[model samples]
Target chain A: MNKGGAFFGVGYLLGLFVALVAFWLAMSGLMKPLLLSLGAVSVAITLFLAMRLDVVDKESAPYLRWPVFIGYWFWLMGEIIKANWRVIRACLRADLDINPALVKVKTRCKSDLAKTTFANSITLTPGTVTLSVEGDKLLVHALYEQDAEPGAFDDMDRRTAAAAEGAPA
Target chain B: MEIWEAFLANFHAWRPWAGALLCVLGAVLVVIGTVGVVRFPDFYTRMHAASVTDTSGATSLLLGMGLMSPDLVTVFKLAAIWVFLFLTGPTATHAIANAAHVAGMQPVTGARARGDVGEREGD
Candidate 1:
């Protein structure tokens, strides 16, 4: 059991290292040997700090579930686009016809990552914004009252739970 | 093979125009969102409008720029920016909204619901 835990820890650390390297390379876009070496040093220092801080864990390095995460991002992009249209319409209308309302959304996600993903997704969408998260409940403010009606966020909550927490879809 | 090549050639010709169109649309969305921020009755509703500029407008602009990028490195950089914005933008917006909520900023809903013009604070 101890050996298995060590191996799992190594996997997460490795994943974090790879992610840091990729991010550094993409942002730097330098192929020169000197610059590459500097980038390597930076990545190493970051990795060392992360290890020392004990943050190289499953939640911090979630790329192991990249497939589900990517799917969720795509779905979320679609939702943002749809919600953008609604808010844009409300914006461009001659009449200031908007009934804003605050609603409580209870999430089924158990993990902190899952709950955060759910709340951020709501805030990411244009028509809705998450005000506060308390335990499993999120206080949401919506531009339209109907958009914040009960059960409106059920699908988002479920999908977020599935993607982030690996709960059943 | 000849037809496929012709389509690919046409696609190359159309790419810049498509990118330009997307950029223009994104600019329009941002302007509309600005209007919403100015015209919306309350803080929360205005936040929703600002998010239009954040999410869709920024996305459209970045996607257009990515399409028009001269090389893969630039595209990758744009993708990184897009990811960063998506991650940080909402968090920042939520921070402001949550602060306001915690400070007891009340939303103006009833006046608009009754088909009257909404009132602003100090009005």
Candidate 2:
């Protein structure tokens, strides 16, 4: 069981390395000489730190399917942008119908990483905030009463859990 | 009436002064937020102060600078900073609040919680 965690961490590490390399290369091309040097140095330092640090013990990390997780994030970003627009519009209305309340919900994920990701995602979306996480449950506060509908919260858990199904934690 | 109109026109014409005023407004908000953080009784309240300062200060200063300078890069940087703060501010506050709650620090309430959100009596 623990071996699975390490496998996932290694996978995540590789993904991070690739992204950083691409970012560094892009910066070198677009930026001035001094800026490019600084960026290169920063990237080098970051890679050094990441590689040297024993942060990912692997025994307790969560696994995620990279492609699926990327897709999940893209979808979530769209939702967040749309939600923020709605919140802004609602806030500017003459009579604000804000009904701020915190409610508890269950996380379908078995891993700590998935639970934390779910909680953070809830807070990232506009008008919905994660107030607390106790065990596998989350206490979330929504701007409107309707925003707290159980189905909406449950949907996030299901989607995130599905994304992490094959990934090792 | 004509004299008043001239005075208003003069005020508007002093663009730099207006920009300075906006900058001052932003600074004042940040100071007030810092004071609130120091004086507030709890972590949650402190976070509220931080968020208010983060938005008000950054927005005000950036607006002031952008208004003063017509340079494209400077304006872009200011806008970028504002956008970054908007994305991170509330998220940081939420993270702190969640951590404190999980650690079992109940939010201060009633007479102690100053500016506390009122709770219903029945619930």
Candidate 3:
């Protein structure tokens, strides 16, 4: 479980490049030639070490579908906002309006990346979290029992599965 | 024509206000979450409070900073930090909760967590 998906390939290499570039540009505001060259050299060295480590894989760099994942992120933010409102309202109530329960959520994602994304999304949203993931079953704890209604998570599952490489081409 | 131009300029001036509003909201959320953490009945519920701070508070704060940033590079930096936090926060929370679960700490059932255990465990 500690090991990431071990299928290093061009996709990971590309991911490494994009990530390093983003890191460099984000940190180095000035576009001086010297700074730019130094950043490139740094990025290259980091990529070389990553290659040597053999840890690059679909799981490590699941940003292959950037559009899909970013779209999901925006959508997740909207969901979080809604959930935050709900939790905030609940917080103000005289008696805590909570019904916490642990549930077994079934998932159809085929890959570890998809599963992890789904689980992390659940946790990122307020009032729901993923306790543990084993195979297709995710133990999720929800603040309100109704929050875990049987089919509540299907949309998230389908989206993350589609966002990851698990989607059918 | 001058009035129309001035009115439009005033409308465009909302960017700063929007950013400031977001920052205020983020601070308010963090404060509320801290209150929840103290008031919640158990470890699981307390986790919910912590997560509120993690997701909404952090996201709002970073977004505010990005919106208020003078340059694209600064926005990019804020975005990077937000994404990093988003990736790490929940995983860390899950780790803590999982560890507690493994240690045989069940979520307090019923109205509230028992004070007896709180006294023994130093709350």
Candidate 4:
């Protein structure tokens, strides 16, 4: 097959795989017939465009270390569940008792990606929001003023830095 | 098939009210999350708003829908959506935060500043 056709063939199969997965899940079976038919033409065009696009640097890809990312994600989930429970309890009580404020935390992680991941993880958890991120410093807004304590945010920062360190980069 | 029919046939007796209540609660949570997103001062805080909506609001909606439908397929779809949200939501937020950090956004400080070890460490 010609090089053009070769790339298109790969893209076509990818789209087909996506369509089948969606169908088996029963979420979008209705689109299967249409997708399967148009998949070839669309995939060809997509591949053509993809071959020409060169926006992001390859080095940035190293930050996406799946194993470490998975561990961090699971840890984040546990924190979210815990925070949700706390929020539910607080919401139920007669006293809202929220001392909302923003606090700053710093990290040793040299990579910007690591610091960002940390800030985002904090945002994912309940009762805490990331207000800003400048360099290695992160400003976190917590539902309870006490939660914004330096110790708390710093602990989170350290965990994120560890996850980043464990990443491929 | 008859058992399945029986289940579906009887769904109307309880499903509607359950679905309505769950949906309302989900809507409320999602609204609150959106409010937080708009009210929060920065991107990091905004992530909190998005996460609450995904976990609390979206979870409530999915659970409510699953309860309304006892079918295996519907339940599976609901579970899948929950799982997908659980997996990707944080990752996306992390990506955004990383972008912000690289762009030079700084974090806010609180009254208990001395406790921050980074400051003492000369970071």
Q: Best candidate, lDDT-wise? A: 1
DockQ of each: 0.68, 0.09, 0.48, 0.18
Residue lDDT tens for model 2, B1-123 = 999888778864665678889999888767765765565545543454454466556677888987776555666667667767765766686877777677775544334343334322221
Q: Compose the digit string of candidate 4's lDDT tens values, residues A1-169.
A: 1233566545544554465455454653445667656654665565456445531222233334668767767777677778876655544444334445666777677777777677667767877766566787776667667877768766666677777765332
DockQ-superior candidate, 1 or 3: 1
B15-71: candidate 1 lDDT, tens digit per residue: 878888899988998899999998887677889999999988898999888778888
* Chain B alone vs. reference chain B, TM-score for every model: 0.86, 0.76, 0.81, 0.74
lDDT of each residue in B22-49, candidate 4, tens digit only: 9899998887777666554445445655
Candidate 2: residue B35 lDDT (0-100) = 62
Docking class of 2: incorrect
Better of 1 and 2 by DockQ: 1
Residue-pair clashes, model 3? 0
Best by TM-score: 1
How does model 3 score on DockQ?
0.48
Task: Quantify how close model 2 is to the true structure by its C-alpha RMSD in Å.
Answer: 10.4
Native contacts conserved, per model: 0.74, 0.12, 0.36, 0.22
Choose the strongest candidate by DockQ: 1
Please write out the lDDT profile of model 1 over residues A65-111, one tens digit for every residue. 89999999899888888898899999999887787887889889999
Compute the lDDT of residue A33 as modeled in candidate 3.
Answer: 97
